[model samples]
Target chain A: MRLSNLADYAVVTMSAAARHCGGGRTSAAELAAETGLPVPTVQKVVSKLSAAGLLRSVRGAGGGLQLARPAAAITLADIVEAVEGPIALTACIDGDECAVDHTCSVKPHWPAVNAALRGALAGIPLTQLSKAAPREPNPSGISA
Target chain B: MRLSNLADYAVVTMSAAARHCGGGRTSAAELAAETGLPVPTVQKVVSKLSAAGLLRSVRGAGGGLQLARPAAAITLADIVEAVEGPIALTACIDGDECAVDHTCSVKPHWPAVNAALRGALAGIPLTQLSKAAPREPNPSGISA
Candidate 1:
């Protein structure tokens, strides 16, 4: 299965946001430029992320968006879900009654599979994803 | 991101195949009927799955498809990858040169995220997916 383009863009947008951590709040226009994503798409992502509580927004002069929590506290699952609802691989798992067949036997097991997939995404933190070079030693020896 | 429809259909088709495990080979037409997926779609899925060695095809009269190995040995990763190449969450991780911007600093960390997502899919065996109710004891207690 593949991620939708919107979801992919969300991750990219979030990565750009994480990179700006501690640098200062970033506006949607700035994020769009950083990610090279369309301005409208970036705004949509920012709105969704903000509503999901992953991002905090301040309006008015010099106001911008920032991560609501530390990057390390946010997971890919959160970013993905913010854009695409729960990280369900199948509609059946999301509680949409299967329209294919009433007696479909495979329906029952989808939840566990969905859980396993979500768990995997949850294991990854934005800190790990934002790090440019996790393996290389810090040039400044600041121990990031 | 969402799994492409093809990938989701592939899982449904394979699960249908797994249900017929000991009952003998099943043709693509039968699978189409069983899954209520279009015949052409089922055929396409069958061809890819066969090429990936997840399904073995027998030609000529009485010819059909069978799992290449026991259902327990097959994993969700195998089914998904068969229909949708690698289970990479991001195109950047797929080795495509990022077209967005050269200065995109978050590119490098995607591989780890991709790996985590794939690893999650890999952890789920087809047997788990094909089973209708994993927690319930079989009335026959035949040990599926």
Candidate 2:
């Protein structure tokens, strides 16, 4: 129904990182500053993103952080999964038995539903997420 | 991202209600018993679902609970939204400003992403969710 706060922050952090993709690398402090997130929060998210291979951490001089893959290759689903594990909407799908598991008919169909949900998120590439909002066209030619 | 426990239970509870559709009416206790959910939980969920108009409360002696609409007419999105409100994944989409709102490019496109996510859930009718799982085709004809 809703993304955890960590998952939401991951998306914002990744989007900030993607903006710096063309400029080479960015540090957690810079990303945190740009995104207005706390340094510790950014560091926590950065570590997870790094472990998930979404963000690569570079060691030593001139080294910092960079996306492990191209921005276009990353997705909302990927970022969410990086912070929240898999994209399953229900725990029963992951083998955690629910109270109604034995008699629940809906359980079998969750895979298809989950796939559709994931597909929706996957369709959005990080490249798109990193861009500025396009100005909406004005029929009257008046800019807001 | 996972559905809150209430939303997940809503799906199970509704699916149980759908099974008893032809039998005229059922109570929250019956739903709780059938779905193995606690009676209090079922009562709370039933109230929400009823208020959302997904379920109708029939009054009097012979009356109990029934689907407000046909099972096929109700959807996973409707059920989820009934309990969890709108299906927007991130809070920012609902006007809760995030720290990165001033520069977050992803914010503008969330409506499309959210629509797609909701569409996935909308595509699943409660009728389909209530049906028993189909037997998988046995290629070798070896029964387990």
Among all candidates shown, the one with the greatest lDDT: 2
lDDT of 1 by residue, B1-144 (tens): 556777778888888899898999899999998888889988988899999999999999999999999999998888888888987766766667665764655565555556666766777788877767665443242211
User: Fraction of native contacts in model 1?
Assistant: 0.44
Root-mean-square deviation of every model: 6.2, 5.0
Worst-scoring 10-residue span by lDDT in model 2 chain A: A135-144
Query: How do the residues A1-144 of candidate 2 rate in per-residue lDDT, one tens digit apiece?
Result: 888888878898899898888899899999989888899999999999999999999988778899999999999889998999988888887878885545778887777778878888888899888778733343232110
Docking class of 2: acceptable
Candidate maximizing DockQ? 2
Give candidate 1's error at residue A82 in angstroms: 0.7
Q: Cα deviation of B127 in candidate 1 (Å)?
A: 2.8
Scored against the true structure, residue A143 in model 2 reaches a CA lDDT of 12
Model 1's chain B yields a TM-score of 0.87
Stretches of candidate 2 off by over 4 Å are A60-62, A134-144, B59-62, B99-101, B134-144
Candidate 2 residue B50 Cα shift, in angstroms, is 0.7
Q: Where does model 1 exceed 4 Å of error?
A: A19-24, A135-144, B136-144
